[model samples]
Target: MAWWAWLLVQSVVWCSAGVVAVLWWLWVTKPHVDIPGPPTLPIIGNALDFLEHPVTVNKIRDFHRQYGDLLRFYAGPKLVVLAAHPDDIQHVMVTSKIVERDPLTTSAMRSFVGDGLLTLNGSRWKTHRKLINPTFHSELHGNFLEAFHEGSLYLSELLATDSAGGAAPADVHAAAFSSAMRSFCIASIGVDPDRLIPDISKHEVSAVMRRIIVLMQTMMVRPWRRSLSLLRLSSEGRAILMYYAHLRKSVDEVIALRSAATEEGPAKMRRRLLETLVKPGGQTAIPLSEVQDELMTMAVTATDTTAMLMSYTLALLALHPDWQDAARRELKDVFGEGGDYLRSPSLAELASLRVLESIIKETLRLFPVVPMLPRILTEDIRLSGGRVLVPKGTILYVAPFLTHRLPQFFPDPLKFDPSRFLEGRSGEEHPCSYLPFGLGSRNCVGSQYARLEIKVFLATVLRRFRFLPHSRWEDLENSVLSITLHTFKPIEVYCVPLQESGL
Candidate 1:
């Protein structure tokens, strides 16, 4: 109604618009280091590109090619620096003491893995590293071999039966593979893997395994897409929580079994960790619950991972019969057709056969069971190339995917050539390269156990039946959940009996 009132209102509106304009300029000029990249969007960043091919390893490789070694990429709203050089990776691993596995990851993975070594950090982690290091000592290798032998033999028998019956092929359950491998590891610590499984039958176990795998699959699919109406509902979100409950209950049972077992036989002997867990500070007082959680952790991380890897390796071998044939021939030459190189072969005897070891190395290169290592920086740290300054809270990721396939390191990187690992050489011609199980202090502690399990499974199966893929190479594709790279199909193959070698 009045001229003065109208002018006052107009002044307020103009001030608000001016503030918004200045904020936009600051947002537009946010510094991004020049490492090549395909165009990135304003707010969402590379979230869509990541979800587009999270299951396949190719997406990560493309980032390496387009962005160069130390490029910046965003997942959801978080900025992550992907490291390509081993030196830069080790720098990140060693320099920052406070880096941790992503908090959201630990919370979600605790759905299945629990608070195992895979997720633990800082002082607790150091205590764990100090305690378990001795378990893998050279002398103790014999004690672990018995469990590895028995479990591997059981796996061997399983494949043999499938070959004999000529049943429809199997999809290779991720949890079952993980659980079974962990059973072997658990048994070495005096707990039976199967008995630890709560009286469940093979059929029931497989069903439970499938459920857990599906829960993780759902997480990957619904990732940044959780804003969608369906996923936001009470029913869909509630289902994920239920899966976690069952997983926790099952792991808790196994942990109890490990806790109850006493120190009598070699299997029952507790390493340094047991002393800290069961008998703290020479008091001889046992905190049985931590022991239980530690046992669960090992099982949760170790079992599914090794199984996924073995499954992937088998699928890859089926796809490439030439390598499969070569591996089989090598096995026959050394073990003399089902002679059990696994049970009684001395380290010297095993080492004499260089070819067998080479194949294992190559399998690791192509299908590194765990493709990515994720950490959050606690402090600002400089990498080898001054261009990359890793700041606190920046989630750092190092992928075996890019390093394993780099053309500079391994010639014609995608091709499966076992000879590249001949004579204990780096599969990659590139230095600080080829980290299938990672390196330095933070390397996969179960590397030895994984190698033994995979070798035994491959050796025994190939001896019995030659696996030939049913579909074309193009049909083979990987479907990943969390960390493991795996096939979505049954990995169908014909198991032709070897006439000369009696298996």
Candidate 2:
């Protein structure tokens, strides 16, 4: 044989040997626990499976049906256990003693949010939760009622103008986002929306936030950038750094102003949510970095999710004019032909709008803003009704999207029946069946705050205008999964003035 031929043959033999040795090692070191999942190829595992589904919640739902509650899949090299059953969700979210967040998800978010309540785990999470809980109490939220009312009115005016008094379709998602963002700023950050610095105006800040959410979702799915050094050089990475810098700069300015004002006199300072964090003297004077993280978390959590809920609820109500009429009738009875229903309602009045509340609940159930909740298993967990053992370090996912759709919990699951959520009408449901805000210790801290904002916005808008179906209404559910679910296409609806519509 020729020397070149001999060399090529040797190389092939050695490469084959190396591949065999690696496969042998993998087989020997594989986890001992038996769990059901899609068969994975070596090295890549189920990465291709994820790539195929990408943003499809239904694919994951199919896996839940096929695998029965817990499906053990590998993303790249990481083991991910998807838990869909209410019992499993109850244990993972509420019952599990270990509540550490999945590093993969939280670490990605920490860049934008810092070590706030959303990203923190263990003692840090506990500490921040305790500190922030009081800020969300009804009294403080009540103070923001006027902010919600104002924000909703602003949205109504903007929509009416955009629609040319219901002569054309207006993008409700855009209007809802602006309205919710404004409400979040006033209620959570304690800032006047108009006064937010020109450099980081509401529209600019929203652009930055949208960039961050989209980039974060992209990174989480692809995860190609290996390190901070490599990531900083990429286009997406560079853009995020710039946008986050703008975001942080705005937050820092607000913090600085609050701090200086705090120094002047405690009595003079109005205790808004942001002020509560920066106030001097507590078990721990929260560092500015921590406060910024919490603020970012609060901003991200409150804005998109609230907007999504409002947009979806309004769209659904538009589809069912009878329900819209029902809600408006309730509003008319409570506000009596509208003399400042925009202002705060009494607790008694809020309770009376049961139809609107039910509609919101039903909307949240059909389209949960945070579709998948992820956690890291700090300890080994039992799975499949205790038939399988899941090893530690596995990523656990509790899918409220899947749970909310299960037929056992929701009859005629795909139906848009607001009456299903009416008090006493709902049959015995698994405690974890309808978790639009999640469940247990780590449930969304501002759930009540979100609910109130939605109620205020819905009531204010429905009273002034009637939502009529538009051209884009048919594609409302074609949503892309950002950090929160967002419509893949813009959603527009006709906003007819109540008087014009003869409602």
Candidate 3:
């Protein structure tokens, strides 16, 4: 053979040998776990499952049914374990070493939210959490209560206007988002959204946010586009960056206005969360960029989650009038009957809303805003009493949605029963079984604020309007899992004035 032909043959042989050697190394080094899962395709593994099915919640539930409590699947070479058992979930959440969020899931989030509380990990997360914790104290809730009440009143007015005084169905989710965003703005930054951003409407900002979240979720399923550098190369990635820039600009403008106001005097800073956050002199002073990130985090995380909770709660209540009446009676008892229904409930009065709280809990159990919590295991952990081992470097998904539906944890989990959460009935449930806000030390920091905001809105709105069933309720089961859970269609409800409904 000629010299060139011999060289070509040698190169082909060497390349084939290298590929075989790498494959052998990967096979030998792969972590071993005694877990059963669905059959996977080589290289791609089970990624086609997500790509083929748009509804992730349903697909995850199907996997749970097929593989039992602890199931494993590969997301394009990444080993992902879905832990539905409470003990396993608790172990994963409480372990200090396992505090890091899954890089694949959070990479897109970081671009949108920066390194805020939701995406931060390690000592930086700890420091930020420590600084932000005091802002949500019970005492400060009173300040937030005013914003909540105002937002709720605005929500009622919007619903009333949209429903044509009970003649038409109203978009509950849109109204809830508006209300939640308003309350978040006032409480977090001490400014009304309308006044702060005069040119852009809240609806426009919401649309931008929704688009950004959908793009981020798209990046999550396609592992190839997981990193920012790789994502920027695609059209979707560029769109996310553009949308996020708009969002960040709006938030920064609000922060700048709030910061300027804070500079005026200490008196002006009262009851403002931004004031507390922006002020210097802590043991570890936070940078301005960190403040902007935290505020943006609050805007993205708090508003939508609370709005979804409110929408789901109202939808469920509309379907079950008896529960609605029961909730109203509780509200009547606290605020007194035939009085001003629009009046804001005090901190003590808000706390007195047990029936409303139960309804909220049940709604969350049924439709958790954040259905799946993703983490990456740093060390080898044995679960199920050491009978099963999940090796280090594996991706872990502590699915509250799956855990909440487990027959062992919640009886007849599909049923919408608010009474299941009333005091004594919930005593038998595991601590980690019902984590609507999440579990462990790294759980949502604004959980208390969210609960309080929802209660205030529900109390105000339920008092003014009686929710009736709408045609859109049939689409409730069709939810899309983005950064947060969202109904495939807008959740609509018939709003009848309390007097007209003869309540």
lDDT top scorer:
3
lDDT of 2 by residue, 1-503 (tens): 99999999999999999987886576556664576889887766777776652365556666777887667887655678877788878766766655677877876777668788878988888888987887788767667787788788888887888889889987776677778877877887777876653343334444445556666666676666424455577775665576567656767777776766625344632466776787533222577678877877887688778877877887888888999999988887887754455455665677789999999888888889888787888888776677777788888878777778788788888888889978643655777788888777788898888888888888878877888887344466665655676665556688888762235
**Clash count of each predicted structure:** 4, 0, 0
Local error of candidate 3 at residue 171 (angstroms): 1.8
2 versus 3: better lDDT goes to: 3
Whole-model lDDT values for every prediction: 0.59, 0.74, 0.77
State the weakest 10-residue window (summed lDDT) of model 3: 262-271
For candidate 3, list the clashing residue pairs, or say none.
Answer: none
**How close is each model in CA RMSD to the real structure?**
5.8, 4.0, 3.6
Ranking by lDDT: 3, 2, 1
Candidate 2, overall lDDT?
0.74
Tell me the spans in candidate 1 whose CA falls farther than 4 Å from its real position: 1-32, 50-55, 94-99, 163-167, 172-179, 182-186, 198-247, 254-289, 337-347, 424-428, 475-477, 499-503
Give one digit per residue, the lDDT tens place, for model 1 in 308-345: 66666666688777888777767667776543433444
Error of 2 at 181 (Å): 2.3
Between candidates 1 and 2, which one is better according to lDDT? 2
Question: In terms of TM-score, how similar is model 1 to the real structure?
Answer: 0.78
